[model samples]
Target: MSTERFVIIGNGPAANEAATTLRQRAPQSGITVFGKETTRSYKPHLLPDVVAGRLDAEKIFASPEDYYNERDIQLRLGQKVVQVDFNKYQVILEHREVVSFDGLIIATGGKPRIPEPLEVFEDVMMTLKTTEDARLWIDRLARVDSVLMIGGDLTSLSLTRALINIGKKVFFIIDAESFWPLPFNERLHQEIHARLREKGVDVSSSRKIKRLTQLSDCSIQVETDCADFEVGIVGAFFGLVPDVRFLARSGLDIDRGILVDENLQTRFRNVFAAGDCAQVYNPVIRDYWVSIGYDNARTLGRIAALNMLGGMIAAQASPESIFSLNGVQVNTSWWMEF
Candidate 1:
């Protein structure tokens, strides 16, 4: 009999956890993980430390190469999975390579969102989503004295402090739309503004960004509804959206994200999804919702793997938690605490 084959799409915490679980349960099964990133799986929450020069980029990987080799898990880094043919049970790569799988897990995670107004300037806008993004900021910071952040998400808040600690002026524009999945209220906005001001950040009163012009000197001229500023760099922190664009027309139900049942399995039994890219069904609410944060992603990944191995395990909804940054309550993951 041929050994069972498993394929995981993604290289973040969720993907790593799923791969580990599969290896543990089905020892004889062939496991393969495809990651779009060239580097090993690392903690994205620690990206601020990388930008601040407090942590070395090399030390960020959660699992070394030996981990996969020892487990006989094939880790294909820098390979993007462009599509999945659920009917044929095949995973298609960008270069048109197709691999058959008995079981599959999609944990592609999320990508940084660029606001509509600033979409044209995406080439010049900086974001902190991947290791490469962090390294880019580290290289660019030496030439930059100040950074203009267009949105104030949890990542933007963390990066704001990191830049300030490095003696770089941070101009923050608070955009309520950027704080998706996290409920944003006027009181919360005021508290965030107050905390940022106390931290020596230039918190802007305007929330709407009207225009962004790339200057000849490689700087950006930002024009908000009520203010204008020229800064050495412009960072867009409009939060993340599901990175499942490639899954379109693949015949999976996708609304905001890939829709899954309580078992973390898609409509197809052999196919499952976890992490930020999945919008899980809530029996109680009679609706679907996406669970953000590291712990939740790991938990979902494990459950998805178990169910794939014939264990019927329903994923529990993770409670919303707030991280306190100097008495300011910010809704985010625990790892986000600086």
Candidate 2:
């Protein structure tokens, strides 16, 4: 008899949780994790701290590189998986490297959703998701006096606060009529908006940024429904979508994200998914939405690992209520802007 091989994509929290769980259950399993970024697994939430210069890039990783080596887990970084040959039970990398597995887990997570209006000015635009993203824009962030950000979610607010912390003015533009994106009570929504405004954030709603023009010096001229404004840089928190383009033709069940059952198993038996990439059933929404909390990702990863090993553990971390606004509002009180 041969030991099983487990393969996971995206070395973020979800992937780490899944790998740790797999190691505990299947000790002899050949566990391998693939990360698109070269850095080791880190908490995505702390990227804002890094951008704000409060945390160092090296300190953000949840585990050091040697941890994986000590645990007998393989880490394949800097390789982007582009295709999956389900029949062959293998993942094909961008450069045509193949990784075969007996059980496959897709923890690929989400990518920054850059709006079309900001696409042309990509050089001047930023989406703070990865360590590399924060490092790339950190120097530019220092030279900027004011920053323009689009969206009214938690991630948006976190990034806004980070910019404000660095002595840079922040313009938080909410494209919708109301500032809140989630279906929270009107009182809470107003409360959050008020708090942001109180912090000296130039918060605006009901205006959509239509286009962005990058000047020679890398500043941005943004034209919106309300008016045109020039700013040092422009960013959008339109939220994240599953990085599942590689599976577009793979015939996987995908709606908003990779659809998984209670055990986080996809339509295919040998393949499962979790975290931002997996849209598990949300009892609150009555439909599957991406589970964004740390607990939710951890629970999903554990459940996915068990199911991968023929165990039937049900997922319990999908929130039953929408108390906080996109899980970003609660942290607003932790930091002071200006």
Candidate 3:
């Protein structure tokens, strides 16, 4: 076997799993993980549970520092990849250091999409992407009397429940016609709506926020299509786009995410992307999009590692899943077709 080094640029579950798999498959291959966060990769999808006080932050981590140490993979936390050079297969970090990799995997997760113009007032809102974001909300929750949450996704609904549990008045604004547009049907939406309202959350559907105005007192006035509502804080969890800026300039075919073939190979023969960042041809959906859940990330990571090690495996279909909150428990499970 060749002693080629593999580099993973991300701090999320995808990056962690891929690194672990690479170590197991190619013991001699030097594996290094570069993350923009301070802590080991944690499950970001469970950030709401952490905010809701249902889960401890430490328990949300897929693996700990000792786990990585046991695998002999180098860990570089709290580091951001500023730019990349595909021609040279090198990456530039915020610290002005250049790292080169023989095999590269871009597992960088998406950033929270704050609407245009409103992004100028970042202090009035928070986006839940990393542990820092979750911790910030935990500290702010006590100071805020009311929360204006924007989005109808599962994460937003869970955050609404958490805010209401803490006795903070909650107003949910959704631009969609229904809650959780893809996974839930009308019946399921009504069921969820009833449950949320019973918990004292005000749910507003088919509403769009025009702009966010910060008052002199630091309260936020959310101007919507229907009317204006004032609250102490605003949280948005619409969804995530693929984190592909580094790969964008690499000449790799990118659609929703970095495009890879059935073998998980990018246009560059030595590079492969997996997890939520890699868009592979889906047999069921008949298109490539970043796989959205943790299980998909795990499978894709293993697949990528195997492909990188020059192994052949059958491609499997991607599954659909949904996240739901049952009281204090956050249940994220596979969504089966009836």
Candidate 4:
């Protein structure tokens, strides 16, 4: 007969460290959270140093906003959970509002695989993965001069060192000729591809973009059997997809993720799934993946809040776990000498 009220949906970093470890180990439990990003949950790898301006925007907030209201929790910003009924535990939001729970922690995090004929809004394509898409690619990298980037991982070398330290001009594609393949190995991808082509970043690597279209004066046309350029910005990366569409018609077992086991439980009970969209059981790549990061979303939001307080937890976070990768890259003739 649990009556804890610890709802938590997702605000990233494992739903704010599993609502501060379930409010400091169930201190009368009543966590709340909910957030679909209006704020708080920052540190999405510091949105590439706030788009390489070198971290500002309140130092990528993980706190402050009254630090989750002085820890009483109750964050709810922007909302957007869309449904989880689970017989009657309730969750439904996207304006309809329903939220009632004894222990629901989905920790919703994930969504940035924008493909599908690359939706419009020309003036050069982009997709950096939040912080409002890196502040709209830091205002389209100060109105570009040249920048192609397609994907080589580590966010295309940190957006190719923030567009070669803001001097723009930075093409880079990758279908994989090398770089971070299943976790960097071909000699650390030829030593980070020869230190990113000795800091100039034109690195293509096996190429493969196929189509992107947007000309008519706004610039950005990317084809690629080997080349077709015309950029001002095209940054693609294309990797990351798991918002789970509110458990897609909710049957509750979901394969590539939300499968849960070793207690993080979710064949639908008190209901629980953790950050990066829970595809648990990746004992260092053993399989059953799904990991988006933020310390595996605070270690799967503290093992789905200690198995939602029954205390039979195990998921110490897995799947491609990265911890640090430091940054820096430049080219286009030392852009601005930084």
Q: For each candidate, what is the lDDT?
A: 0.84, 0.76, 0.72, 0.68
The all-Cα superposition gives candidate 4 an RMSD in Å to the true structure of: 17.0
lDDT of 1 by residue, 1-338 (tens): 12699999999999999999999988999999999999989988889989999988887888886999899999999999998999999999988999999999999999999877778889878999999899889888988799988787778888888899999988888888776545677997888889889988888756577777878455788777787778999999987888999999999999878999989999886899999898887676556767677877888899999999998898776334433232222323434443
Provide the lowest-lDDT 10-residue window in model 4. Answer: 328-337
Which candidate number has the best lDDT? 1
The TM-score values for the models, in the order shown, are 0.93, 0.88, 0.86, 0.33
Clashing pairs in 1: none
Best by TM-score: 1
Q: For model 4, what is the error of residue 199's alpha carbon versus the real structure, in angstroms, after optimal superposition? A: 16
Error of 4 at 155 (Å): 1.8
Off by over 4 Å in 4: 1-12, 29-41, 49-51, 72-151, 169-201, 204-279, 282-290, 294-299, 306-308, 311-338
Q: How far is candidate 1 from the true structure (C-alpha RMSD, Å)?
A: 3.8
Per-residue lDDT tens digits of candidate 3, residues 41-157?
787768887987888999898876598888888999989887777788888899999999888877885666655645675667777878888998888776669888776665676
What is the descending TM-score order? 1, 2, 3, 4
- Estimate, for each residue in 1-338, the C-alpha lDDT of model 4 and write its tens digit: 23479788878788888888887777776778888768677777668778879778678787777877777778878887888878888888888979788778787766655555444433346777668888877776676688777656666676688668767777776544223213445675676667777888777577666677777444777788887878877876655556887787777887645777655677887778886677665445444545555665687788778767778867653222432221211000001111
